[model samples]
Target: MASIVFAPADLVVATSDDIKVRFAGADLAAELPAHVQAPPGAVGVRVMVSGVRGPETMQRDSGFESARLAWYQQRQDGGPAREGSAPTMPGMLVLERVGALLRDDVGTECPSVAGQVGGDGTEWKGSWTYLPHPPEAARTL
Candidate 1:
């Protein structure tokens, strides 16, 4: 799997067409296609969380459901943006917590918090690494 690290400030923004993922210190943006099977050599996307601050309890709420809901909603709208006529594949969005990794195989459909004290405690700050799953053919090699 190939990995892309995202800093705390990096934004993973979702749009009507695609999810814009930014890599730290780089201008590269990975557009995760929606509602389609990945092409012959498409890679899947996974995220690993690190540098989390706060109690260990927060780890339990890995925010998988919320992510899945958002992904489903996005696809229901229209799906990710495409570059050309070439059909793009929808990659999985896996969220890896500190100890346990939650896998959300984002095929067709699939599925956080932290913040100030007394402020819902639903906000969390951390760095995440994006691991791209190798193409099916490559995995067997």
Candidate 2:
């Protein structure tokens, strides 16, 4: 009864134990070393992309609340402390990079990135969704 979140591109990461196989959160736990087990409720998966990958699953009560908090602080602080952040977690910025950041004002100025690579190279583009407030009373949408 666990839910999953998949990245548009694949991801690669390691585990506490050493086992050689593509790593995902729910589907591939059995293939992992005996020590790999999902917390009480979760799944398994694996994805390898762009020199970055990791297990892809989330928990209902995970520290997501804290994640947004840190993101807010970082965004407001403007990354002034790039060298050191107080208590870092892996998935902290991911929520902003993907689906969640699509609606934010960050991309207001769409810079013309392509058309001038000069060698037919592809430019990278991205968007995210942001809802910085608490769900209002959980009423019908």
Candidate 3:
């Protein structure tokens, strides 16, 4: 449950392979948590996004679907192309990363970050973080 808050200008971009990030230049890859499992699934990616979104803001109504769309659109347009929309908030997104399986011990307060693809298959839960360009920054995703 550790957390890190990055300045609005620090993150440069993110892609399917890795996130290109830094205080300014593209010199570093933002580190993922140790609990992260490989072969990351789409639903898990969404959880990490929620983590990056942090717990302070309103949970996106469409979950990460809408945010993902907006982010990709920003990248495709070469920069922030939206006109006069609500200002984007700046803060570290609080993504849920599971450390282990909770199984039948799941509790009422249990986070959605756990679970796995069982023999019959199951959906993974959680997301990662990214500093989406604030409206003022208007930079690429």
The superposed Cα distance between candidate 1 and the true structure at residue 102, in angstroms, equals 18
Candidate 3: clashing residue pairs, number: 17
Which candidate has the top score in TM-score?
Answer: 3
Candidate 1 at residue 92, lDDT?
24
Q: Model 2, residue 108: displacement in angstroms?
A: 48
Question: All candidates' lDDT scores?
Answer: 0.31, 0.28, 0.29
lDDT tens per residue, model 2, 11-129:
33322122112223222121222343334433222212121333342231145446647766886787744445454333323321222111113323212111111011111112211
List the candidates' TM-scores in order. 0.18, 0.18, 0.21
CA shift of 16, model 2, Å: 2.9
Candidate 2 ranges with C-alpha deviation above 4 Å: 1-14, 17-57, 70-87, 91-141
What tens digits encode model 1's per-residue C-alpha lDDT throughout 75-101?
A: 667666222232211212211222223
lDDT of 1 at 94: 18
Candidate 1 — worst ten consecutive residues by lDDT sum? 110-119
Question: Model 2 misses residue 29 by how many Å?
Answer: 28
Candidate 3 positional error at 15, Å: 30
By lDDT, who's the top model here? 1
